[model samples]
Structure formats: structure tokens, C-alpha cells
Target: MYLFTACCVLCGEKVKANISLCEPCLQDLPRISCCCYRCGLPLKNQLNDTLCGQCQQSLPPIDYLISSLHYAYPVGHLVSQLKFQHHLVHAKIFAQLLLTTLQTHSLYHSIPLPDIIIPVPLHKKRLRQRGFNQALEIARPISETLDIPISTGLIRRAKYTQAQSLLNAVERRKNLRHSFALIKPISAGHIVLIDDVVTTGTTVYELANLLKKQGVKTVGVWAVARATHHYK
Candidate 1:
């Protein structure tokens, strides 16, 4: 059990303990009602949890992906508040939203849950500057709720690559090359990668490829939001 401040982080309206944001404020955020289960990108005129045209032709390395919200306006601002301003309580809200999406998508039948949750690692240098890894914080509550252990110290940043936000998709891919290394064997066959946002899909793709090469059976990405509805 955790305690949250009575006021919402965005509008300062009083909120319940179950959620940090007020209902009206929560409704204002852009949501991905129907997203491609494989890429986690919004799908137009399609049912929820269905594959998009791109994934239909060629499957991606990620076996499953889900992002509850679109990274627009207040959602992006809220992410910034947590990432930069150290508003940690927002992680719980993110976890709730993601859990809702996951369960909603799996309403008809059981969707196999990942064996472990691995929040994206931050290089020691970046970790020092940020004071915390937002991804890990968000993953913590989800792990607690689902009873899935959060794995750490397995995959680490091998090099402090340039920040992804400043780079284009090509540059982002290049920047992340050889950036992550597995320090030990991942015992879990199915794993979930947690991140604050999915922008170009470069970083997760790189890490997923690394895991696949090492004989991991499945990889799923559960992000708080997707920067764009489509892959860049």
C-alpha cells in the first residue's frame, strides 16, 4: 500500500488514493484505444490488440507491445515531470494505466504474462545526472501488483550513448549500437522491457535483438506512452 498526495499532479485538484490524477485531468490525455499488439503503435479503423499492416507483412522482434497513452501535450509534460522533476508518484498512475490496457486487450482470453520485468537500464553517468531511472520506478509497482519479479543487473548499458531525444531515427539506431551488454544470463524465457516512452523504437529494438541472440524465447515492451502513433 502507498499513499499519494490528495492533489493531482497536473491541475492540483483533489484525487483519490487509487489514482494521483483527477478524473477530468485523466480524461484529457490522448489514449491509444486500438494499438497494434506487436509494435505498440496506434491502429486506425482496426480492433484493439490487432496487428497493423507493417506487422502483418513482416513480424517485428518484439512478440508483444502495449502503450496505453499517446505522448502528446499533458502526457509528455507529465512524463517530463517524472523524468526531470522527480515526481515519483506518477509512476503508480502509469502502472495503473498500463495494467488497464493489458487486461483490456486480453479480455477475451488469457494473454501470457511475461516471466520477468526488466526496466531499461541507465548508464551510471546518466543515472547520476537523473537521480533515478524513471523506467524502473514505473516497473516497480507493476511488478508488485502482478507478482512478477523485476530483474536488474543483468542487462546494462555498455557505453554511455548520446541521448535518443536529440538524434534522428538513423542516428538513434547508430548511437545505441553496442550500447547494451548482458552481464549475466537471463533465467526467464519470457521478458518484459519497461520504458517511460517509445519514440523511434530504436533502443528497445537493439536490446530485444541482443536478448534474442542470447536464446531468450520472448520479449515484450510495455511503455507508458508512445511518442507517435506510427513507427518513425
Candidate 2:
């Protein structure tokens, strides 16, 4: 049961203590009922193909990917507020939703708990402008709940590129190329990348490729939501 009373972040309605939104609002959040296990893309027929066509052709560097919701409706609104409006509490809301998926999703049982959780790094300029990396904030609760260390310095965002959302699939890949540099050594064989939202999966793909070259045996992703419109 909820502890006390608080204002819902989404609706400004009264909610139980420690809850982000009212029950109705929470229930209205968009969800991904079926998706590609490799890239978190929503799929129409999981019974026919577990992996999407892109995944079947060339596997992403990610060993597994999990996104709990579609980047739609109030969920997208929440993410926008968190990213641009400096609403840090939205990070906690994202963490709580992702944590629930990690515990209950079918894929959860197939992969070992990550040795370290790496929130996708932001370029210095972006980090300075935003004042925070939303992914890192979202990852904090998960790290504490799962008892996994959050590795902040293992990778660095070396290039300041255009925002992924502003580009098409090809452009997104090109925008992120060599953007991340491994600045620190990591002994953890199994690691997971955390992000606020995953669209084309280019960012995580680049990261996972880098990790693989560095002898990281397994790379996975945990994202709050997935944008399925563009994948190339």
C-alpha cells in the first residue's frame, strides 16, 4: 500500500505517497505487449518471428534488449518533460516501470543479471546544457534495487552529434559513428546499457560493438520506451 499523499506528477492529482501518478493515469501509460527481444521493436506477430527482419538479417551488438513501453501518449509526454523540462522525478517513474518489466518479462529469466549498468553517456556539451543525464538518473534506482554497480566512466561520449530523433535511420547511424570512446577498463563480462528511450537502436548498437571489442562478453539494454517508426 502507498504510504501517504502526494501530487501526481502527470496529472497534478492527489496520489499515494511515493507514487508518481494516480492509478488511472498509471494504467493509461502505453505498454509494449509484444516486441523484438533483440531491439525492443514492437512486433505484430511474435508467434511467427521472435526477431524482427532487421535483427534476423544482422544481429545488433546487444545480446538482449528490453523496453517496457512504446514511445507514445502520456509516456512520451513524461519523457519529454524529464529530458527538457528538468523534471527529475520523471526519471524515478521511468525506473519504476522498467524495473517492473525486468522482473516480469519473459526475457528476464534468460539472461544473467548484468555485472554493471552503464547509462548511455552524454556529450559534455549536452550534459552541461541538460544539467543531468536522464539515463543515469533512471539507472540509479535499478542499480540499488538489483545491487549492480553503475559504471559511469567506462565509456565516454566523445563527439557532439545531432540528436538521434532529428535524423532518419541511416543518418542516425552515421551521427553516432565513433561517438563513444571507451575511456576506462571494465572487468565485467556482462553489462547493460540504460537509456531513457531507444528508437533506431543505433546508439546502443555502437556501444555494444565497442564493448564487444573490449572483451565484454555480453551486452544488453534496458530502456524506458522504444520508438518503432524508423529502423534501417
Candidate 3:
């Protein structure tokens, strides 16, 4: 069977589905590398751990970091849409991609499935304004696929700091230093911290630090995208 139809595409390329991006534009989305196993940092030489020197010198509070895509190009555009445009449907697609990537990696198999999933909490003010937390939207699909329990009230944003986008590393660390706190006692267990994107790792570090202090075991970070920066 054959069918013919005409549809307008963003790039003026004919597309079967009605979508904002054409096939070529979608293909231009950047993918993450598998170099540094611990975090997704690009690697230079063979190393024992998949950790870059920057992470090694000043380690992230979480034990492991995994990202589905690099924060660049069309991927970054999609992230912006999901975050700012309220296109929450993108979260499921992003989570599925992450699941597929994780399933293929041998290293991911041995790690224990997180006992619980926690999205980076948003302050009440921001939550009310945005009408939703993007992190929670992403985490919901992941939790559904992995069959892991999710706890929204476990983590709270006690103080809202200046947007991380406006801060440098040192300032970012200071801003996030005391931003997070546990709402109630969380029992010790493997926990996965979910967020839409990670740049300097300040926010996740603060959350991981708090969880570790609370005696949680093996905290790992799972985010949709990570900023690509060369660690010299």
C-alpha cells in the first residue's frame, strides 16, 4: 500500500509526522559519550574508573553519574522546550532513551536498582509559578519503567538560591550549599537523584552530601543531559 500527502515541516523538508523538527534536524541532536564511566566526561586515555580528573580531585557527593545526552545542539533545544514550553511529553521520550542506553551498558547491570527515586525538589514558589517540576515529570516515567518507588516529600528545597545558570562554579557551590533538606527521616537505601540537566554539579552535590550525611548508601545521579566542558 502507498499513500501521498503534503505537510509543512520546520526545515521545509517533507515529513510524515507533524512535528516541529524535520528528520535531519532531529538527527542533528548530539549524543553523549561513554568515556568517563562514573560521569559522562570525555576521556583522554585509558583509566581505571570512568572519572575525569576534575571529578577525581573534587569528587561529586554522589557515587555515580549517568547522563542520557550531551547538553548541546538539538538536544539542548528539546530540553529547553521541555523545561520552558511545558512540553512534558518529551520527558517520556527522554526517559526511554535513557533506559535503552542503560540497558546496553554492562556497567549499569551490576549496580543495584535504586531502592527509591527522588527528583530534585523545587521550591514552593517556583513550583506554583511553573505549575510543575520538570525533574519530577522526567522521574515519573523512569520510575514507572523501572518499577522503583518514588518519594516526592522526602526531599524539600528549604531555600531558593539564585538560578544556577547565572552563577559560576564557586558561586554556584555557595548558592546551593544549604538549599536542600530532607522533609522527614529517609531510611538508608540506594537512592537515585533525578534532574533534567546538570552543569557544574553543584545542586546534585549538595543533595548527595545531605543524603550521605543521612546515612544513605550508594547515591547515584541520573539526569537527561549534562554540559560538555573540557577538564584541563
Candidate 1 ranges beyond 4 A from true positions: 1-3, 107-109
Alpha-carbon local distance difference test for all models:
0.84, 0.87, 0.74
- Which is the winner by TM-score between candidate 2 and candidate 3? 2
lDDT tens per residue, model 2, 22-126:
888888888888888877888875741288877889888898889888989888888898899988888888888999888888888866898999999999999
In order of appearance, the predictions have TM-scores of 0.93, 0.94, 0.85
- Candidate 3 per-residue lDDT, tens place, 196-225, comes to 888877788899889998899788888888
Each prediction's RMSD over C-alphas, in Å, is 1.8, 2.6, 4.8
* Runs off by more than 4 Å, candidate 2: 1-5, 45-49
Model 2: which ten-residue window has the lowest total lDDT?
1-10
On a 0 to 100 scale, what is the lDDT of residue 220 in model 1? 89
Report the number of clashing residue pairs per model: 0, 0, 1
